[model samples]
Target: MTTVLYFGLFAMSFDFISGYTGYLSFGHAAFYGTGAYTVILVANGLVPLFPTSTPFMISLLVGGVFAVVLAVVIGLVSFRLSGVYFAMITLGFAQVLYIFVRGWDYVAANPRDGPSVGGTHPAGFEIGIPGVDQLNLAIGVLAGEEATVLGHTLGSTAVSYYMVGLVALGCYFAMQRILHSPFGRVMLAIRENEERAVAIGYNTYLYKLGAFAISGFFGAIAGGLFAGFRRSATPESSFYFLTTGDALLASIIGGFGTLAGPLYGHLFDETVREFLSKSGQGGGLLPYLRAGLGDQALATPIFGDMTLGVLIDTLLNGHASLYVGIVFVLFVLYVPDGLLGTVRTRVGGTLADAARDRFRDDHSTPERTEGDDE
Candidate 1:
């Protein structure tokens, strides 16, 4: 799903800074919200830089730049404080922005409701290269304007999915490459032991700042994509501290330190939530379970005013948050290294040992045959 990919990118950004530098940022959503608002403002011609609708690509870059600017300011101030102190400061800044947005109607379309790009375009949210309508992506399946593709009437959403997905994939690979470089090695070194790094002449603070900035840049880009996908930017979705919290949750579940882990974790998280949300619908998990359980078993009350079926149904309806929290707690207690990390530690070692044994068997000099020994 495009939405999942967009959020995956955001989670990866969170992991980039926090996982590597051990700096937990509680205001990462500030950058995300900023980028979304920047893209929407620029695209809607509200910004003076573009008298007309800005091209989608340019808008995304501008959004990222704005986020990076915010990151620098936040990092400079927050990095002065380490650990929890730094996190709280970042959170304080984000809350300030959230409160300002919620109360300011002159800038926002509505203080409580937030600003939207409007539903004038039938195709959910779309972005086009300047003067080239054909080169555009609309980010919904059948919700957008119909376009002919290979004799099929496919909406802009299908095309947009591919476009956005490709961008996300490219961003992931780029971050991976960065993490494998010499700079990445320093980042790891800093994470492993900041004091030792400093003692060895490495400037840990600068590296942390750099990591934070890079994280902000990627986060903003993801936000821009989300704006384009949803065709609107909402303060509640953008500036809410929960957004950052969700990213943190994903990174922890996915595996910290590994660049790809958060991406996979987010995808898994989104998929589970989607299923849970859909379970109550006609074609969802609830319907199938209800059918299998039959009317009698379902209606049998397990407790006063609550049937066994009702409890299960209630959980299937809107209990994703509860489930996620439970999973997080269990992970923290049992699998501290996280899903990917645990797998790497367990399965990876087994495969590695097997390979080593095979290598030894192949490379070891064979005992001389009886005749050759003679």
Candidate 2:
């Protein structure tokens, strides 16, 4: 759930620019990776950029700044091109970064895969609230050090979940505020018609650059949270174009332009995946199906000695991705506006029609005065 929240926040960052400005960036992961690496490096005192050990929260902010700087540089070059050319340039830049991280041991300790920053205190990148000794962010279970909140004992993972969720919520609201501002309106105008926006005295290039920087800043924050949660950073996961692709997918499915929709979309995606994996486990859907079919039928051998139950479980576990892809295709064809967008359109139209009818009836009916009655 924490992972979903951070990923949702990241997706919203992408939507803030791509959804609003219609410029689909394919290198958003560059900012994400920069954030992850910066946060870890600063927190661990691995980089001389910060003296001594930096606070976790402070490092996160610094990481965001780094991403913003990178965004400015990338935007200057990438924004020069429009449409598919822009996307390809961004993608090319991200791939170059990926290759650099993978091959350079100076950048990442384990260049082939990535860097590892997880372990016990004093060894790993330990994050916690400033001046609060009791509250520390640790991934997974923290045995013998569990803290109770509101009479409920919360483990390390729960603590991380709450912290990350709160940060994600803050980021979501911030993006919402930005999207509702005048600058955001300019971005929308640029998206609708860039040439018209330029004719109207708005510098379209500057507006796009600003939006890209904002998006990159938030993306980095999400990356910082992710790195802290996972206690590691990998070029394959963080710098890969597929990372941006996942966020893009979430945005589309959740409803682009709705700041919080991606969160719901990501949550739904995660839920479906969890359901698929657990369906094959001991008390899951597979067991229920087997029980309903009974032993003889399940053992009836659909292929050679392989039972029906085995086949079903195998498909559920192994071909889960295949099923997800099919569902995505269906959504694209039938529900192009996305889940929330479609819901809002239908619900809003219905309410508007109802109100119009009510207004017509009320106005059409003449008031029965005393003289008229007589």
Candidate 3:
């Protein structure tokens, strides 16, 4: 599912920097929105001027590049702050971005439209380019264009699903390899203890900034996939703390600092939310008991959802921060190591012990040199 893939990528990207480096960037969504906006901005010309230039692909790359640059900038600004200060500054910056995007009337009025095939000669006319006269994408302005490919109608929502799925899987494996690399080990050291890492001659700032930039770069790629595939990138989706929150929720719920935890987390959150929303379609006791009874059940809308989003969107759905708060509380209260961390501690410790014992036994062999050694 795109839902699973999207949030899986979300978790990995967030954890790649935040969980690994211990920076805990709250404004991480800025990079993601930046990617979406970047791609959309880059490909606007290609669709109209050079229709066969593959704007979609260019948009993805541009989005990723923009994410990397923004991450660098974000790293520079917030690298000085740590813990609460880092979180505060990150949150502040995210709000600033959200407000700016929301206030911009041009993008708001028009929003960003997707890359469309524009034509010169109208009425089902096929035109060829000057130099490359052979290749012509003569698409008719006929009915049901969206459902067909080259005059063949095919039910192809599955294509989008598979594409996103592969992208997410690629990112996941790549991240896993990176996490196991020497650089990733250094990042873990920095996360475990920045002072000790610095004392040991590690450039904490560089590593942190590098991790942040790389994480954000991938986050933007994911965002671009989401935006381009969806064909509609809105301000709400692009610039928001909650976007980051959703990723955080996925990370936390599915077990942060693990290989595929966020993927599971997305499934959990999306399934529960979707189920609750679709099932809660009636004016319940709270609404009917009140004076106003027009089949409207909630006081306000939350992230375009009814019920719970309306009830506590302010304190709770500020993204998934509210829900994650409860989860964090539970995690701290009971499982301090997180789900995967807990499992690794139990299993990895035993494996290490066994390996150590084997090594000791291998070296401790009563050497046949008992008579030769002095």
Candidate closest to the true structure, highest lDDT: 1
Write the residue-wise lDDT of candidate 1 on 1-374 in tens digits: 77778888998898998998888899999988887877777755666765334566777888888888899999999999988998999999999988876666644644455543422232235555645678765564445555677898765666777778887888898888888898898989988898999998998888888889989999998998888777677778999999999898888888887666777788777766665664544255666777799999999998899997988777676777677778789878898877777777875643456679879989999788879956
Better of 1 and 3 by lDDT: 1
The TM-score-based order of candidates, best leading, equals 2, 1, 3
Clashing pairs in model 1?
123-144, 140-157
Residue 55 displacement in candidate 2 (angstroms): 1.3
Give me the overall lDDT of model 2: 0.78
Strongest candidate by TM-score: 2
> Could you give the C-alpha RMSD of every candidate to the true structure, in order shown?
4.3, 4.7, 10.7
- Tell me the tens digit of each residue's lDDT in model 2 across 1-374: 87898888899898888889999999999989988887766655666767435666777788899889989999999999999999999899889988886676665644455544432224233455755666655443332134688899977777777777878888888887888799989988988999999998998899999999999999999888788777667777788899998888887788876667677777777766665654544254555676799888877788787888788777665565677677778878888877777776876743446679778988896878889967
Candidate 2 residue 92 Cα shift, in angstroms, is: 0.8
| TM-score of candidate 3 to 2 decimals | 0.68
Error of 3 at 232 (Å): 0.6
* Candidate 2: residue pairs that collide: none
Candidate 1 minimal-lDDT segment of 10 residues: 115-124
Model 1 off-target regions past 4 Å? 110-135, 140-155, 278-284, 301-308, 314-317, 347-374
Q: By the TM-score metric, which is better: model 1 or model 3? A: 1
lDDT of 3 by residue, 1-374 (tens): 65567657867798887777777888888877876665554444422343334444455666677778877877798888899899779878878987886666544324354222122222111212333434222222231112345887543354455556766788788888888899999999988888999998999899888888888878887777666555546667867898888788777766666757667767766654543342322432332333353335445444555554356334323234344456557866787655655665776743446689779988996757666766
Clashes in predicted model 2 = 0
